[model samples]
Target: MSKADNMLSILWMLRSGKKMTAQQLADELEIHVRTVYRCIDSLCASGVPIIADSGPNGGFQILGTFADSPLMFDAEEQKALVHASVFAQEAGYPHTDALGRAVDKLKRYTNEKQLTQIERHSSGLSVLQPPIDPEQKGRLQCLEEAAGQRQTLRMVYGGSKGDPGTGSVREFDPYSIIHWKGQWYTTGYCHLRKDLRNFRVDRIVSLDVTDRRFERPENFSAKDVLLEQLLPDPAGDPSLVTVRIQAHDHVLNELKQHWLLGHALIERSPGEAVYRLDSTSLHSYVPYFLLPYGKALTIAEPESLVLRMAEVSRGIAEHYGSMLSGLPSE
Candidate 1:
């Protein structure tokens, strides 16, 4: 057996209602006595319930209370757990090593038939996700730990993806870390801004967990905070305007899934969607969002929005026209 399997086997041996010495465990598993001692220590470090009694009659055993407890997952439940682990990893879950160990333990305890079935299910399934950036991955792990342990973090925030590691430094108390779309975000209290804010983990140039501690607000919900930011209550902002659009039926499915327009949708029909958005965004983000649809989408109301789209089209044409002029005769 591999070292990991050896360790799991030792766990099983200890649960037989009989005290066992390290030498006996090593002999039974056909490994070294020292290996058994190391496995015991590793199990303890992993938070397994183990007791070491030191005396002539002393031996190591799992805590009596937990000794009889078995891994309760049946075949289908086991397959589901394996599949879920794959989904979690693909979503860039931090603490992947711990997750791997947990899954290994689950597989180690299952019988032969169940193990074969699990392998078959796992092989037939696959998941696709955006590639994880190493810097973002490290920051995500730190943010998650800081949130759980209530530790404040000092980080340099802001910068374009092409040129990171150059930004303003600030202290933040991470309340939550979440994965949305293909990006990672840490929502928290920013000491610099003196308000709650969310920062994309990828945009964080550098990060360090601080010794400072903080008490999270009572009944805090980071998800709710993020949702409100993405889809604000339009009534609260009197400057907002309603914009309506019509798209071909062939493209409506994808248009309905648009991040900003989809969330702001007030009403919809076969080829039309009405959305309420601040004029600033309507002039900026909305134009870029609908430009790709071209003729498939048509702006119907708010003449300013229609004019802005025309302006965007004109700018694109002028810029490309200049670039083509500079390129030597084709």
Candidate 2:
């Protein structure tokens, strides 16, 4: 995460009415204690009213009045919020109409000079440039409606294709819709599986909001579930193959930005830098991720991957070779 992200995240943490120690902040942000303190200093410098108490039970706190007002933001905070709002809007958030109104209201709150400055700066800002499928909007809307009403959703869900009669109609108590890794998912209690399940919005073949309402688990945490199920394990999975990449900083940064698994950053010392890659599906994920990097990266593990890369190179060469062969003889 960037410094600006850390500052805003700290503010959000305090806003939740929980006092967080610097150590707690460091753990959450995956940064050192000194970096957490530095972020706190940056937040304070930016005019955030963060309060620190120095008792054993005490930690950092922010008064709730700031949230109640809803209009307080320093210049940097305003820019960050505006940028986030733009991203959310572009990403087809379920509450797009409300987000649009909120952005307009925020702009109205800005003074003439601030508005001009924001406009001048925002011209260069853009996010969520990926092409969203048209069907995604409908799926998000259905999930949102079900979650809001505490209603169950009856849908035809397509799971991993195995054989005949694999995918089937199912009912689930929709709890929430979450955006993760550029895809939307709905988590709920699946009646068919007799357990909680996360359904990718795009994989839902069809959906209908049902009259049956179900209570969400009081302790249900979407973030916890996502972390447990989605994020690659630190020790690496025994089943999935490990890929090691040696590359320059620019390529590493690009990989980090584009792929979360690539953000591992195993080692960086002088000219020797290495990144360990772990994903749920190595066959599908590795080739797709490495193709764009081309010759910039070197694969250091999993002999299968080296052979796969060779196969891909051969396929590309064959494709071009055939294309050239098809041309009229000179």
Candidate 3:
């Protein structure tokens, strides 16, 4: 047997409470007695409590309490488990109540050393602020339940476009509730629009499960639909505007991860890269997403975005300048 298999077999024998000496274990496994002693040492190093005695009547034994313990995870596995649980709890994963209880139980089962490693690993992971609010949570739960039941739902949903404060109410057949981009959305068959629609759960003012039932399309796949919506058309209008920017590879790589960048390209240099951003709505993309990069970003393209960037910069400078003027300058 290989070294790992030998160690596993030795562990099994010790766990059985037979109290076999190293010589007896070597005889059973047809290996050197020295090899058996080394395997036992390996097991001990992995946190297994294997005890050995030197006297004539004495033999090898495992700690009685540890032998009966059902938990089998090693230190690293325990740490990984704790890290995953804490991440889920912080990320507003659905079924928060049940997950929270399960995580609490997991903490109870972990030892002090394992807990220390968990804390160390978790310190590097961070979930950004403004977690799901109560209204959004309740809406998500309602959508989840409705999707499972395949019940038609009535919702007052706003548009994803400009100033959608007061939206119209409509009936929809709930298909699925999706968690994407740190937001929860429900995709369903909209009776009002007579087509498929995706509604943001946070934007939904009210939701009601109707008594009417509707069958989801036989060949419908939520993943396929989402991919189609997310991935931009590569063969789309060849006349797509190319807006270049100068930024570090790290910043450029971060921008590439966005769903809207599917058709974009990045040309690399020594320490900087020029990004070719292609979007139908440059106005929205530039102000909301690109401007946040500040001075690291420079527009090298059609005069429109360059002017827009300058205009936005001036507006921000004026706004801050006005605020600064209200305070006494030193």
Candidate 4:
């Protein structure tokens, strides 16, 4: 038998509580006693609790609990582990190959009955996720490796609105991998900007881990920082103000689920809600957001916002209306 196969056979025998010596194991497996000793040593090195004794009657025996460690993961545990992998896979987990091998080992060790239960659980449950770009997976992995080692990364990062092909180069100390609203972002200290920034993983055109290393800020959370950057934290700043709106209860419920509006939201009633936001978000994003709701939502305050929405609607109308100005009446 091959070395691995021979080692596995030795382990199985020891697990049976037979207390067999090296010569006995060697005789049963058709291998030399020295080979049996080597196999036991290999198993011990790999964390198997193989107890060796020197007395005339002593023989190698596996610790009772260690011999049966596979049973610790009951059927439910196995199913849960496998099901959790679905979420990771959907999110384009970077080390998918390693994850797959780990899961395969779980399945390989299961009994027929447990395997049937695992299949039953897996077949009955599923998750819906947006498809991720293939290239983002590699970027996520590289960023993870660099962050784990406190290494800096150099890359061409597309600015929030720039095309990836034309992105400028930057080097940053990666801190964490954050998942928000179906998108992945790497939050870190940007060398070019000399400030903390979040770069969309998909918008990374090229990336390389450098030998350079840096310290992560004390008590930092990438998700918290990303949220503060994306939405409402600016609302609390002295420069921002509150805008209140009223809508049907059902419509308001749907609106509150929005990533931007949800965080900005300050107070709400059955028929009204108030959101705190900077002028930029109010004028730039709210108009388009409310346009989809038609008359379902009313801007109860901030007369400026009402007027701004009107201006936006008018501009859009004229922009599209010009296309039909020369067309024949229909």
Candidate 5:
């Protein structure tokens, strides 16, 4: 590795629960002890708080200040940080309560004029969708506590399959709360089912902290476990459905760029694209994809989808026709 890369690797190794001797670092980086010492000196000169001990058992360690110090960033860096903060808040990262504190610290370090600019820019930037309901306030608080203490929580969750008036209750041990696609979800070992499960925060009825505490597995990470459970099962058989659209370049560009369609674009032309979607539920997305194009687009798909779109178009046409006929003769 290069000198810079080796220095970063050294920092990462020391930051975690590991101690590295100069000899060890030399071996890892294929360098000599003198070279390692020179790298260490370079790091210390760069304001990286690396502490060295001169005993048989002591090695190199990262100082607490190194981990806790505020980072200096240029104007562009500041804007990027603010943008990420806004995005996190929009996505319901319960820990944003802590981000507010960090932002306050940053403001203190920045000059009055720079701080003013930052505030103005942040205020002007807005997320398209507002945050989800704050009803998960208590749930988020409980999850935070569980994560910090590595404790288990016995909570009552409402099932999604039930009616709003009649929700089924289940007890779960929350390992972590994750925000996916603007929705908050908690994944953990389900006490009632004797296995892992994920529950949406909005669907949870109540939360209860239990006296029972369990040891977190040595290899367990809430984020990793949640992602594993949330991924769609790939073992299912794939189905191919063809969908055709005749949208203008603007719409086609959006479709290519943002890829509003969940499936892959199988084919495209000057003003049209054909998608080979894996889902059988094509009806759900047809209306949305067609709405932007208005009368300029047509759906030529699995005969059923074509019929459904025709039916919707006929309804719209009849409604417009009735409205025009109802207008006073002029």
Candidate 6:
């Protein structure tokens, strides 16, 4: 194996539950015992926290609670980590801190040659530029503290319409802070309004933590509440709508692995398969699934979604026409 690959293998072995002696590693790598010692020293120097014990039963081991944890990565997880690291750096805050720490850990298990390769690959990656608002950062920090401590806060929040003249100052019992679609929102119980409300963190003009403590509802979960609010109801009906759609084999395989689709009924015919899903907002996701398949898949569903797709097609045609005429697409 290459030097870099050898180092990774050695780290993986050390991280495994089985303790390996220098002689064992040398035999496995087809190298001298001294070379194995040198490699171990290099790993330690790079902050791998490897421990060597001196006894008949003793051997080299990675000294950590996570030593036996699996290091194997499927292709997607590796790509995701690399991409997320780039994004964290560009975000210029907590993500940057996390990315730096992750890179440090990755470097410990890598040799100089592998480090060089990773640096070259990572240099080409970039993160999206985040909006610059120092005040928003401060408010986010305050919100984080309030959420962690379960404290009440008095703040002047700007209205959604962006009229500062109509902004209201009120007290709120912060339950949680959620990031949704690039915007930050703080969901809490408003003392002034006497109701549960979601406030945009960026709209917070002034904030002060209160000494009065509040209790979170025993049955209230942030994720449950968020999903309940997000999933749209068709018209005024709250009934779950089931829709069937044909999907490519690759897409079908991927969807099968998803726990959310466990309740879905699937049928196979010819080169494709159909999935029947019961969701309140089936119309929103049906187009998403169809986009990747193009004309390969058909939506065999509630007639409303079919009409929606037709309208979307008409809109796209109009957009293309306006683009060709050198007019605004909107």
TM-score of each: 0.76, 0.64, 0.62, 0.75, 0.58, 0.48
- Model 3 worst lDDT run, 10 consecutive residues: 270-279
Residue-level lDDT of model 5, residues 197-216, one tens digit each, is 77878877666677777665
The regions of model 1 sitting more than 4 angstroms off are 1-70, 159-166, 321-330
Candidate 2 stretches greater than 4 Å from native: 1-81, 105-124, 131-134, 159-167, 234-236, 258-260, 263-280
lDDT of 6 by residue, 197-221 (tens): 8887777877888888888777766
Clashes of each: 0, 0, 0, 0, 0, 0
Give the whole-model CA lDDT for all candidates, comma-separated.
Answer: 0.83, 0.74, 0.72, 0.83, 0.69, 0.68
lDDT of 3 by residue, 231-306 (tens): 4444463655666666677877776676665345545564444434445466656566777888776666767888
Using TM-score as the yardstick, the better of models 4 and 5 is 4
Candidate 2 lowest-lDDT run of ten:
271-280
lDDT of 1: 0.83
| Tens-digit lDDT string for candidate 4 (202-268) | 8888888888999999999888889778865734577777789999999989888998788878888
Point out where model 6 deviates above 4 Å. Answer: 1-133, 155-162, 165-170, 179-185, 192-212, 217-220, 231-238, 252-289, 325-330
RMSD of each: 7.3, 16.2, 11.6, 6.7, 13.0, 12.2
List the candidate 5 regions with Cα displacement exceeding 4 Å.
1-79, 111-117, 120-124, 158-165, 188-198, 212-236, 256-260, 266-270, 278-280, 315-330
Instruction: Evaluate candidate 5 by giving its C-alpha RMSD to the native, one decimal.
Output: 13.0
User: Model 2: what TM-score?
Assistant: 0.64
Where does model 4 exceed 4 Å of error?
1-70, 159-165, 315-330
